[model samples]
Target: MKPSYPLMLTALFGLFALTGCGVVAPGLAAAPPTPVPKTHHSAAKQKPRTPSPVTVPRPTSGNELGVVPILEYHMIGPTEGRWQRTPQGLYQDLTWLYDHGFALVTMQQYESGDMNLPAGKHPAVLTFDDGDYSQFEWNSAHVPLPTSAVGVLEAFQKAHPDFPVTATFYLNNHPFGVDSVAKMQWLVAHGFELGNHTYTHADMSSLDASGIEKEIGEEQAYIEQSVPGYVPVSFALPYGGLPQDPTDRTAVLNGSYQGISWHFLGVALVGANPAPSPYSKTFSVSIPRIQVVDPSLVASSTRYYILSGYEAQFLQDPSMLYTSDGSPKWISFPQNLSAQLNPAYSSRANPEQ
Candidate 1:
């Protein structure tokens, strides 16, 4: 029998308290909990699984040091809203991206600068936040609904095998309204990733050091418990709220609560334009994402807008976009623009004339 949402929450809350933390109500401040040694075994401490190698056509020329867009999405439903993208709109977006030479890649691949694509093809990161049920749902037969986000992605991938179905879903408590471990396992079993969005979606800016740790650490614990050996390498700040204190900010990047520690390689923000190439010096752990919403809802710097939307900007000057060199063994870019490359990737840098 499938576990009910309330029972799941009860178990999660019990684990939370046992970890020397208290359940934080949304928007309400809670007293700092004492830190205790983590007694629960976690596979998160183990090394993350390496992605399988993909073969693509070698590129004769392309810029590997250009910006890559990390598109942020919320709900996938019938009507588009400020935080929702209609299924039809999503299909259109995928079609447009594919036609424009954009290939789907996970946030992990983008952050690690390991996105290996065909010659002249750019990498695009798709991320879903909140983990709404509309984003993923199974019919009575246990198959993904045709209109759901996962279903759409699967269909698109079937149509275009080159555009692999891979994305990162940032989850909060009661993800997909079920909090089912099977759902989490299924996502990981496929190519999709599960990331942390805090336990209660608390605004980080309002949280103190302990609160911050509790929020992040509890979620980490939950994920580790739900999906053994699967540790979220990235963190998406709730409401894109960044802690004001420098130390608190550091805690967000790396923190521990009652022995349940978390170290995120990448921290995602709420809005703005495309992120700098991982090989670029401008790239950092704090990554910016472009909100995928209706063009009419937002004035400028919105989706589908030619003058202000990031899509148009990239289309206007494809050179500014990161085109894969088609090989993970080397990072390729124009020698003239070599100065922009981060020195850490110097060993793999392959600047061409």
Candidate 2:
């Protein structure tokens, strides 16, 4: 019933928003963000010069396209009760991420910026929404307990020490409790990062003006207290709606995340994001995220995502770069267009003579 970020994505009629051609994903939320106030740039006279062309990356090994495919998940347990995935399923997914060459990154790293195509490393983020009990359950439950989230990550990290890995979990207001905090501390010490999933996954769009403020203010306060040093800058729309954010500033104030986007980030059941264009296309609202579950899915998805391919060029200098909304391209690499001239245009009369 909720509209998703993909729904907000209206690519130049599919010229963009091309994740991978596969099965349709489930709905996370609905609606698009309302435009905010803007100020126009003053005009200034300047010398005339040739303008450079914008870039649409060609698909090739290394970085056919500049992007890193990140995967998002909810729960990992045997239940499959709500949005949960069994531990066995998680193991299958993680093992694939390892063998395939995805170097896991933490929120701290993301905050630092500079996401480049590290040599021989496929960078991808594994995020889990709603801090469910399943996280601690993986290794915590001894009687019939399976590998906890930490346990799985630990094993994966040990085996592939070369691949850097980390995960993000949005905790509710509920206390980490004495025991859970210790487990969480272990996760943080290892490499995991925690964030705020909005006090109780509260619906941002449905609330009134003042109501929206409270939702954010209250949740932020609780999240900060519940998880020490956990300052959330990103917010996942509860039920996936956009109408709430623009109407409210407090939300952004509390959630000042540098990268805020989401879309049909694939499902463990079926993957739709292919490499080369996985994270290449940009939509402010719904940035694409890959879903990691099946072993084959992980392997195939890795090949298709162009994280290690063109990211280097992009990082070196992002040409035609602009905000989420397509506007003026203020920066470029190699100082714009270079390559040889189209000589044919200069000598139309000669005609190859």
Candidate 3:
């Protein structure tokens, strides 16, 4: 069996302390409480079995924890410069997902006032980080392969218009140039969401609160300035990282950006990731992320993305939810509304057994 993460952390801390003191301390024998099992989710009843369903706990409040996919992406293009993905590869990936049981959703669909998810299911949000100009060209250019992420997204949108599909681009102020801002504005006008990526892609955590705000908010202000009324509310931490706890690290221009996208916002990294996304789950401090490594990885991994949402909850729920057979151990919540988790959102890492 895999050792618990808390235990490992404790052991590591103990070792560090021991190294300093050169002896075991008194009253250090006691261990912390085991995390409560996420009850609301599981593939089977209590018993030994494979760890299939991600141990994401069901949200205590259904309305706060809406079921949906927030798919993250970066440079989706042919250039193999680490972040780019090919157009043909991207299309194949999307086509497979659409053909399967999945439906691409918009952040708007996730808001409780708009639409509710069915029981045991939630809509997925598609996101792009770095604001690469390549995204817009997908529509205009007719390159041999789909040429860009935007091109395939348009293809998917056309194929499934009412599927509630929309993409959020976390615009980077410095690296990527402007010609696409107008196109970005246009996308937002058509129900697509726009979000902030940071003016210079600097580390928000490294700065003081004011400095952080300026770092995050300035770019947002710039985007709005470039394209009248262009505000990208949602936030994607630069370098896929975020600020400290309870830190309000957002810059809402057109709309409020309370929601966050996980790091690098990649395609393969989005397996139905339950909340407390694999990146961070501290609620306040955790800036979620999905690594957009490349096209091959994206093409191979869809089930992981779909299941990630359910699993994210499973990992957080203290109930230790599981099934008798343990196939689809998801913590069920009322559709449409998102719920809060119990025991507080943990900032430290917790390992699953």
Candidate 4:
């Protein structure tokens, strides 16, 4: 075997290098690929999801009318008087109403029949008399005082988050103390209602028709001018006094002075009674208010009687209440109570097929 030395050396080096580096020679065939096992398929499939059913209260039927309780509050401060309520007391009142599923509505809403509350909710009105400085007051820095009624309400609103923060303030000559005009504007701007309590807050019953005009008309003009866009639609009778004469009532109802006029929709008296439903015939002119006076006064008078006796019961049992359901305004109540309510308020009845 005679081979060239240099060629033999080069070939041997190449073979050794290939073997050391784990490389296949050019002439060698590649290794065969490994076989993969097949996976088994399942016959079962996933079922589609069914949507959740909408939750609504059981449908009620009848004509039983719901009674709305309008609570009347006077001064909101630390004063110890039957007509005044402490800030803590005001908070307690609001808390009780809110906890009992009562939605705070304005007198205007009550008058205009805007009583559309969500399901399982009742409407109640909070009214403050005299437009007392303690009812709504600001510090020297122009901030609401903690003891003020509005301050308590706003603070409560923040804490509860879902409670309706609204009320009506019956104003005489002064609104929320100093800077009366600014306070009036503040109330209107912040969704609060301003109502006339007469200019002098005098005994409206003793006043003649002209005197009533001066008291009411002048205040109306002042409020109109002060607030720019506010026109008080509701009125609270001064000292709960009403003019007995039909003529006097008419004048108070629609009186004009200084080119300004008052067309009061709802007139509140000093009496302690629950306001009839705005649907009632007597609701427009003689709306009654439940006074939130001293506990001693409650014992002496029946200020809390209507709400405690009747309205509270209605809230506890929706079957005894009349509320408009979406279309056709179906007033809901138990069928057995149909005799208790007026026929006009009842939902349409279907005859047997």
Best by lDDT: 1
Estimate, for each residue in 25-105, the C-alpha lDDT of model 3 and write its tens digit. Answer: 222111121232345456455576676865555333322233234455556555543345567756655664565334454
- Tell me the tens digit of each residue's lDDT in model 2 across 25-51: 122212222222235544234555577
lDDT of 4 by residue, 182-285 (tens): 88888888888999888877666687888888889988988898899789988877655566555676667679976889887767765455565554333345
In candidate 2, position 49 carries an lDDT of 58
**Model 3, 58: alpha-carbon shift in Å?**
20
Which portions of model 4 miss their true places by more than 4 Å?
1-64, 296-353
Residue 260 of model 1, lDDT score = 88
- Model 2 lDDT, full chain set: 0.42
- All-Cα superposition RMSD per candidate: 11.0, 12.7, 15.2, 37.9
TM-score (all chains, Cα) for each model: 0.81, 0.55, 0.53, 0.73
Name the better of 3 and 4 by lDDT: 4
Clashes of each: 0, 21, 70, 1
Candidate 4 lDDT score relative to the true structure: 0.65
Local lDDT at 276 for model 4: 53
- Positional deviation of 332 in candidate 4, in angstroms? 3.8
Query: How far in Å is the alpha carbon of 164 misplaced in model 2?
Result: 2.6
Best by TM-score: 1
TM-score of 3: 0.53
Give the Cα lDDT of each candidate: 0.74, 0.42, 0.43, 0.65
Candidate 1 lDDT, tens digit per residue, 1-353?
12234433432332233223322222212212111223645766777788666454334588998988888777888887666788888888899898998888888878776677877799998899878888788876657777888888888888998778789999887787664577788899998989998988877889989999999888888888898999887888776666777666778877899888887768787655578788787677777677777778654422332213777677788899999877876788988889998787787778885
- Of 2 and 3, the candidate ahead on TM-score is 2
